[model samples]
Each structure stands twice: as C-alpha cells, then as structure tokens.
Target: MWDLLDPYSYEFFVKGVVAATLAGALCGLVGVFIVLRGMSYIGHGLSHAIFGGFAACSVVGANYYVGAGAWGLGSALAINAISRSRRIGADAAIGVVTTASFALGVAMISIWGSRGASFDAALFGSILGISPTDLWVLTGVTVFTVGVVVLRYRALLFTTFDPEVAGASGVKVARTDALLMLVLSLSILTTLNVIGVTLVAATLVIPAVVARMLTNSFAHMLVLSTAIGATCGFVGMNLSYHLDVPSGTTIVLTGAAVFLLVLAGTGGRRLSRTARSAPAPVRPEETVSLP
Candidate 1:
C-alpha cells in the first residue's frame, strides 16, 4: 500500500495526474461532438498539424502552447475553408491540409535537429514533466469548452444532426461549425503534453466511441464518455507509476480496454436478443398442407 501511494507524494506526479484528468475530460466532452459530426479524423489530423507550430516554437524559444494553439486554430480554419469548396470533401481537405502541416513540422525538425528539445517527448508525451502553466492552460481550456457546449447546446445539436434544417431554423451553421472547430483546436492543444501529438486522438476518440456504443442519448453519452476518460487518466497514471511504463500509452490502452469490454458486452447482449427473437423451426410432421 505504501509503495502504491508513494508516487502521489511527489509534486510532479500530482501535477501529471491533474493534467491528465483535465485533458481527458476536455477531450471526452469535445469528442462526443466529434463523433456525432463524423469528424473523428479531424482530431488526428489537427494533432499532427499542430506539430509544425510546436517545432517552430522550439526553434525560436517561444511558449509552446501559444504557438501550437495558434497553429492548430489556423489549421482548423484552413480545413474548414477547404471543406467549403464544392470540389473537395471534408475528409479530403483535412487529409491534405494536416498532412502538409505535419510534413512541414517534420522538415523543420530535420533541419533544426532537435534544438535541445526532445521530439520523442513531443510525439509520445511526458506527463510527469507537465508544468504548472500547462496545467492552468488545461483548466482554462476545459472550462471554456464545457461553457461553449452548454451555452450552445441546441444550436450545436441542430447543426450536427441536420445542417440544412438548422439553417432553416435560424441556426448559424457555418459559425457553429467554426466555433466547434475552435473548441476542438483548443482541446487538441490541451492534450498535446498529456497524450502527445500522436496519441491525443485516441483520447478524443476511444472514450466517446465506447460511450456511444453503450448509450443512445447524446447527453448521457457525454456524461458517460467524460467519466470514462477521467477514470482512464487516473487509473492509467497509477498503473504507469507502478509499472514504470509511459503514462500516455497506459492511459490510451486503458481506454482501449474499456472500449473492448463494452464492445464485447454489447455484442453479446445483441446476440442474445437475436437468439430470443428468432423464429422456431417447424418439424416435418408439424408442417401443414396449403389448400
């Protein structure tokens, strides 16, 4: 028990736990919308796209969050813009813009050769190294995201389910999309340190997907997903401390495990329901002749 509780005594571990919790909650909340909107790929794309700004900030000795947030917002808007074109599909736009941005980041890194920063940490994360400032930023972003979702709940729902109907009903579909994208960009920035650029998308996607599998109501899904994400963060951090593994990977794997469990449970229930509803076969002797 003492050994298990020992890691919590350290300030860094505490900070990492707080950071992971906040990041997980924010990702889970925003991810509900992402899954509903069929924009899961955008999360992965934006995570990569922000790497260019991260690399640039490293080269110039600027605040990483500010630089990355700005870059991510820009990429989000660019994706939105490209998706507006009749010639381009939304997924195609996301792929094109984010891939280009990721390539730019890679090129910058290759040219700069780390500049005393660890690319491995940036890509895979180092939760124990989370700074106080980063934690505050995560808090702010989480609060802002929740506020936006609460304030614009109806509008967001309308836009997500039926943009044409939402527009007809006086909802600003385009503006709502932009606002959602902004929130998504911020959410990605918040998770960059906790889950890193590569695995952040998993945090955004897995919990929401698991929640979706378990619930049909959107509000219930949001609550369940957020709870699942927070649980994963707390448990994964503890597991990481005990096992001496990467915190981010542990967190993501924990979520993955939950998803698998839910999948299996739900599938079993569905099969059971099907078996009960199936028609009984008639015996040859029981068959009747038609007149």
Candidate 2:
C-alpha cells in the first residue's frame, strides 16, 4: 500500500490528498450543525447558487473564486432573510433562492460561452488542476470554518437541542442560525472549488450521515465523519487514477457506500437489542392492575 501511495512518485496525488483532508474536516465540523438542524438542504442550495457567480466571473474574465464566493455569500444572506420573515418557511425559502440562483447561473453560462472560459471544469471540479493559490484559499477556508464552529459550539448546540429554551436563556437562536449559515457558506465554497459546483453537496451531507450511524455523540460523529471523508478522498483518487474514472464521481460514490454500510450496521444492532429487550406476552386470562 505504501509503495502504491508513494508521494514521491506522484506529487499531484499528494496535493489531492491534502485538499480532500481539509475539505473533509471542514464539512464534518460544520455538518454536525446541519444534521442537528435538519438543514442539509441549505448546503446543497448554497452550492448550486455559486454557479451564478462562477458564470459572472467567466463572462468578465475575472477571478472565478471571487465571483463564486461573493455570489454564494449573497445567496446565504438571502436565504437567511427569507427564512426570518413569516412569508415563507425555512425549507421553502431555501428552495426558492436555490432554484432561481441555479437557473440564473445556467443562463449566465450560456450567454458567456460566447466569450472564453470552459464551464465543464467549474461545474464538476478540477482537483488535479488545483493551483497553489487555490490551495492557500482552501487552507484559509478550512481554518475559518473550524474556528467559527468551535467558538460558537455551546450556543449552537443549545439552539439545536432546544431552541425555545435556549432563546429564553439568551442564546440568540437567530444569530447562531445565521452564523451556521456563514460557516456552511465557507465550507460550500471550498468544497465546490475542490470537487466542483455540481457535487459539493456530498461533502456537506454524506460523511455526516455515515458518522451519525456509527456514533451517537455529536463530537464523535464529527470526528468519524471527517475520517470517513478523508478515507474516501484518498481511496477514490487512487481508484480513479488506476481505472481512468472521474475522481469526483468516484469519491462521492465511495461516500454513499460508506453511509449505507454504517446505516445497515446500526439498524442491525438496534434490531437485535429490540428483540432482546422485548417482553413476553401475557396469557389472555392473566390480568394485573395497580392499586
């Protein structure tokens, strides 16, 4: 295995591994909140919205990262505002913004294809082509995301578990929710750059789902999810290299498989425990009543 993964033989593989590790760590950390709040869709929505920004950047020959990041941030803020208003529910608001943003992005791409810049790579990621500047941006995003999650840990947890009680206790549930949105935005942007606009949602949800099955504690789930994501990245990259497959598709599939395995194992264990703990049925004639 060591010989097969010798970094000296292939430097690009090493870069891919590092990028995956950081991206996975960020996803796992922020994804815990996503799972708790049942807002995984928000991550998916933000990623789709980024395509508009990327299209705009390509049209003007501007920096793609700047365009994507700015547009993703704008979408996040819009979702937050719409959710706060009584006019629409959270999921509904997300649906509206994400759908419109994605459609607009597609339109922008069509209009700007007349100029230069390829859309396929941005739509699906270019891991092997990640530049040094992109690596630096990825590193910064990871750090900022992890730091925000850590700092707001208690408030976020309180809000997630018992929003009404936490709010009464001065937890500021709305602020925490928005803060999570911000962290998720950062995670989405980084993952999009690493994996591409189309599949970044997997990084935000798959590992977290797998970890939930393997562990009950939030902290443990986060750690396990990060490990699962990192493993998938490295393994998938090698498989793609050997088989001449797309790395992003392989990695996403690897994540899906891991989630299924974890789910099966967890379900099996619970079923066994349920069977053991079940009480025997009483005879029809036998009746008991408490005084």
Candidate number of the best TM-score: 1
Residue 97 in candidate 2, Cα distance off native in Å: 1.7
Encode model 1's per-residue lDDT on 46-125: one tens digit a residue. Answer: 88998888889877777877888898899888876776668868888788788888888888878876563467767877
**Worst lDDT window (10 residues) for model 2?**
282-291
Positional deviation of residue 117's Cα in model 2 after best superposition, in angstroms = 6.4
lDDT of 2: 0.69
Clashes, model 2: 0
| lDDT leader | 1
**Residue ranges of candidate 1 with Cα displaced over 4 Å:** 114-117, 268-291
- CA lDDT of each candidate? 0.79, 0.69
| Shift of residue 199 alpha carbon in model 2, Å | 1.6
